[model samples]
Target: MAAASIFAVIIFVAMFLLIVLDKIERHIVTLGCGALTLIVVFGICMRSGKAILGTLAVGDFFKKDFWYQVTESESKGINWATIIFIAGMMIMVEGMAKAGFFRWLCMKIAYMVKCRTIPIFITFMIMSAVLSMFIDSITVIMFLAAVTIELAQLLKFNPVPMILSEIFCANLGGSATMCGDPPNIIVGTSLGFSFFDFLTNTGLIAGICLIVSVVFFYFVFRKEIVTENGAEVDMSKFPNPSEAITNKKDFITSSIIFGMAVILLVSHSATHLTVASIGLFIAVITLISAGKDALSLLKKVDYKTVLFFIGLFIVVGGLEETGILEYIAQFIESISHGNVMLMIAIILWISALASAFVDNIPFAATMVPVIQSLASTSGVDISTLAWALSIGTDIGGSATPIGASANVVGTSVAAKNGYPIGWGKYCAKLAPATIIVLAISTAYIFVRYL
Candidate 1:
């Protein structure tokens, strides 16, 4: 490897290991790593006169050309579109939360399940997956986890498996839509793939996986659903599902904005707007129409996550600039030997295994460029490659509690509720199911796409 490439690899691996350890705040680690990448990796390249900024003379800072070059370089380092799209979705999902959207959904699902163990398990897991298709999976899990715990308490059964299944399903459902998961948001906005494109391709596969996964979980969890206290919940004690709405007017407004975001995503091809623009535009419209609560809604966005992505983008961009990703791409190509099916299979399984342990956002962000590089080198279909990676990252994320944001949120919720599911317990139960889902995804990709 070249000196810059080696340095890039060192910084990236160290960062990945730190992140996996979760010893420090993720944003802190990623931003620090990003700065290290620029100072070390890019600095080495700068010494060789191959860096993007070239020589930054004092006079050059005043010139428009120099500033333009700097702006272009920064653009390459951080995808503002992906960052903006994530912020927009965060605000939108926050708005929905303020409107009690998730609570309403949970109440409705709770009612329909009739307090039966089988129906409760099936309905909530399916709802978690289906809701995650559009809503943020973390938010979906928060409401679902809390509510499922209550249901479990009343029905006299353990809720740990239910929460795990929900986490798995939420991550799985996230794979089916462009805005469903953070990884999807990163990949979709970066690649210019529309919501419709995702739904037609990976979305089809996610739906199939949902059905099969539901069956797999049902069997595993059936024994746990046995009620030790009582087999029935007092459904009469629950409030009417409509009572979940805090404000009818705000509910309608938030729903319209959320729905409009999805519509704009689907029709972006005709509207000639970028996916990033569509998301941000809807977010802005939401705030403007939200009246005085706009600032509150804006404040609800997890800026910590935004900063994490920003830093992560810089770190990955450093790898791209220093040619580390290209090297990995070449290795993948050599392993696959120019076969598209082998490439797809390799990308899918590697991503799945890696994402099962790593945070999927950083993993997806890193792989995005690698996929592009592989596409160019091996002349493979970029869409197939992206879809395979998406499926891998999405479902594989649920194998461990720390793997994805939804899993993290779900576990935290479980912990807070006194149900504290350990990583060993979580993986022991969900990892095999994740493997099954991954196998199903690989076959689906091979049979359907190839």
Candidate 2:
């Protein structure tokens, strides 16, 4: 217990630092840290007894035992369904990327914004945010960043503001839908919130934030953009705008499948099917359609992220098993005197600050069970807390250059195009706008859900 506690603390601190620095590859850092966590957990498992570890049936973590003890008692560690679902989603994203869908999409967006830099910038940000509500923020950032670089050079403007705004909007947009962000997906899967529930509640907040972000960005970058000569921009130089794409047919097919998959996700309550099962169905259809090429596409998915998620869950599981999480939740509840609204506020603010300095994915992963336990005891709605955490962690990414993967990737792409987005400058352009919009979102959550 002592060893596990100390190890968790160290890993938590290191992960937070790594995310805030934004210098290293997050997947790589997560892999390293996840491996270390497994090592520590295996040690604890060995010290306790083989029977305790043996009792850890592969699929049992999905059951009531998720909150069980680990003192040489029978235990389980992994959620196989979650692991498989993540693996499948990664493959699907890769398949789409390989099919030249993203590039084509980017080209189309670029064309629509042509010769009108500010409108183009605003339109891209708005659309990117909307796309993020359906797809992963990381994927959206990858596509937008690539196009923003080309558009930046052609327009003779900095890509920093537009890229920054897109990251801001991605978080906001993702907050609007259950499938939008990884944290929301975790919340949806664990708590059984349907897609419409998220859309109806958080979606409205997201729309408000989107409008707020646009207006905020206008003020932030109004001067730089207005001085630029938009008419002189040449669009033809950005050839094949779909250069990063590979297979168009597979792209279209996968997109249609993805759309159906989302519709099914949103209609979860009506169907009574698990997200994991839905993911499996998608994987099967994709494999049938793409065949050997589908298998090849699996390489594009970030498998490391899956492992990292598994490891984080196990680590948090260890905390729950050791009763550490329970203790913290109790401490928080007592401090707030069991006031659910106050508790929600504390969690939201803390999550935002912590997320700004930690990979929101892992941070959200570990917090799920913690918040679940907290809500179970305090009578607070876990769904609202989940949405709040998702909003904080997502939009908080825009508060700093190292805050989110999208910010890192977007800045990197911009730098390559000679418009470097330094930490200080990024903060100057993004922090105020993100803060304002996020504040509006938090207030909405408080008034509507609390």
Candidate 3:
């Protein structure tokens, strides 16, 4: 049994390394490794004749407690609510995109900023952050990156810096709200943290980070952005913001549904409704309003992303089932001597660094229970640990192109448009800003919670 556990751990680590290296398709690696862990571990237990079935256990599957383990594993590993919420939001975002709402918004910003490079960059980054607070960061990146690329091409300016800045801001903005990022949604729902609570706690830090990031980008991209002959481009060539609206009816409908979703999400605590439920309800309403175009909207949802999440849940579930996460938690607690402040710092830094290499969603899911366990044993506030973990994971993903969903989407969009940013280039260009924001987050955590 011990050897089997070790072998499972080795396979899990190898799979994680493959994911971090991004040498293969992530969904394939995750699903394959997850299935292997379950099968191999269950077979080992059955062979050893160590099956312990409780009274409620049933049938051959339950003989070795395999079914029970799977049930428990899924309960901790997979967050169905978060998955459903993301899927619903993807549909809503698609509806809005098809309606030209995002394009209209982008055009409006471009018109407001005109040819002023600094103002244009700042406005776009701020908009990305603001939108990500309500919408998924990846969706925010998709629309924002496209508009930015077009704007950059029109003005004959480099779009890579602008796109990268928006990606970072989008992730930062997501940390401010419960519905902003998948990790935040998972942590909030698991710990019962309210939207307002996130606003007051993590929101403050995220806001500060947004401002700091804007200044950081300004300096980093100053040469590439600030054109000596700024007057060369004619603003008249730009499309009128009003003209960007292709379908007024669809725009209005999407707007109303989106607004209602926001209101419901904000008041989730008072109404006792989960954020996922609100998102799903709004998605349904949008579909009904779309009438015959409903199928088209549904088709726009990112099913691949949803599948990736499902695989991620099972992979992490295997770790929890094997007691590996508990072992990690114990190791951390022992090293920190159960000091709450040190533990907070450790979790923050470790999560930040780990999330920089791997996806934060699965990492957050794995850590939530571990953090909870540590908090319960150390007599620290779970809310505090949750906040630390949330901020860390949210900001850390900015360090690399593969770090977060927004980064991946933004980089891919840019690459498709003939501006391929390599991993080293992305890290060199964005790491400073990410590190600065991370430091600010750490300081804010100590000041606010400690």
Candidate 4:
């Protein structure tokens, strides 16, 4: 058992390194590693004659303990609710995008700030963050990046700084709400936290980070943000925001469905409906309203991200079955001398640094069980540790371009627009703000929870 557990840990670490290096497609790495884990753990169980099937078994392999273990891991490891919820949200966002809602919103904001270059920058940054609070940050960046690129071209200013600021703010904004980021959803649902709980707990800290990041970007980009005609541009050259809408009917329909989804998400505690169910319900309504375009909109949903998450859940589940996560919890507890504050601080900093390079979904999934174990052994409130992990993973991904989905989307958009932002340049520009926000979060955690 010890040898099998050690092997599982090694496989998991190798997978983590490959993911961080990003040399291959993430979904491929995750799925391949997950398969290897299942094989190794199943072989071990079979060899030990511990693979007995229970009364719930229905197939020929049901008599084998290996199959039972596999079933148990699959059931316990994957948070199907969170996965389905994200899928539904993605579908709805796809419908909205097809309707040009995001583009229209971006154009409206562009029109509002066209005359003031600095205000244009700040307004977009805030807009990116705020939009990400309800929608996915990557989608927010997809639309906002296009507008920022066009506006920069018109103003004859570099778009890199503005886009980078938007990316930073989008991630910060996501940390405020449960539906805002994948990591938040995984952590919140796993811990039974409500949307309002996240709003009350992490929302204020996210708002503070957004403000600080905007100020930071202002100072950094002030000199480079000059307009073509001395800080004021010809607004007539810009297209009207209303003209950006391509399908008014679909736009109205999507907006209504999306709004109802948000309302349901907020009232999920009272309604007794899982967030995933609400998202899926809205998605079905969207497809119906989309009429003949429903298939095309459905095709736009990010199935790759959803699959990657499922693969990660299975991979982490293997570790949990092997007792690797509990071992890590014990190691952390020993190092912290069972001090709750110190343990939380350690979890926060480690999660932040790890998430800066690795995907936070897997990191958060793995940490969820470890934090729960730590809480059980230490007799501290699990909610406090959960919040620390949530903030760390959610906000820490802002340190590098590879840290979060929004960062990757923003960078790709910039590169496609002939403003390729190098990893070193991205880190140099945004790492300080990331660190500052993290420090503020650490203080907030200590004051509010500890």
Full-model lDDT for every candidate: 0.81, 0.70, 0.80, 0.81
**Best to worst by lDDT, what's the order?**
4, 1, 3, 2
Once superposed on the true structure, which residue ranges of model 4 sit more than 4 Å away at CA?
Answer: 46-75, 229-231
Q: Give a tens-digit lDDT track for model 3, residues 125-153.
A: 99999999999887789988998888888
Which candidate's TM-score is highest? Answer: 4
lDDT of 2 by residue, 1-450 (tens): 766676766765686577557687656665566555556644553354442353233545454423221221222344444555666666666667767777778777667666467787788888888888877778888888877776666667776777888888877788788777777776665665667878887788888888877887888776666426535656676565556556667877879877877787777657655556666777778778888786677666677677666655555555555556777788879999987777877777777777776677777766777787788898887777777777777777678887777778778877877778787888887778777877787788778876
Q: Which residue pairs collide in model 3, if any?
A: none
Pairs of residues clashing in candidate 2? 99-247, 100-245, 100-246
Query: In angstroms, how far off is 405's CA in candidate 2?
Result: 0.9
TM-score of 2: 0.85
Candidate 4 versus the native: TM-score? 0.91
Q: Model 2, poorest ten-residue lDDT window? A: 66-75
- Residues 1-450, candidate 4, lDDT per residue (tens digit)? 777687778778878988878898888888887766666754554243232111112232222422111221212466666777898888899988888899998888778765467888889999998888889998999999988898888778888888999999998889898889888888877777778788888888898878888888999989878766575577888889888788889889888988898898788767666665677688789889988988998888878888888668767877777778998999999999988779988998899998898889889999988988888898878878878898899888989988898999999999998999998889998888889998998898889887
Q: What does candidate 1's lDDT look like per residue over 1-450, in tens digits?
A: 377787778888888989888899989998998877767777655454345342112233344432122112112456666677778888888888888888888878778877777788899989998889888888899999988888776777889989999999999999999888877877775676767889998899998989999998988988888778544566787678898898898889888887787787777656666655766787888888788999988888889888887778878877888778888899999988888888998888888888888888889998988998898888888889999999988888888877788899999988998988898999998999898888888898889877
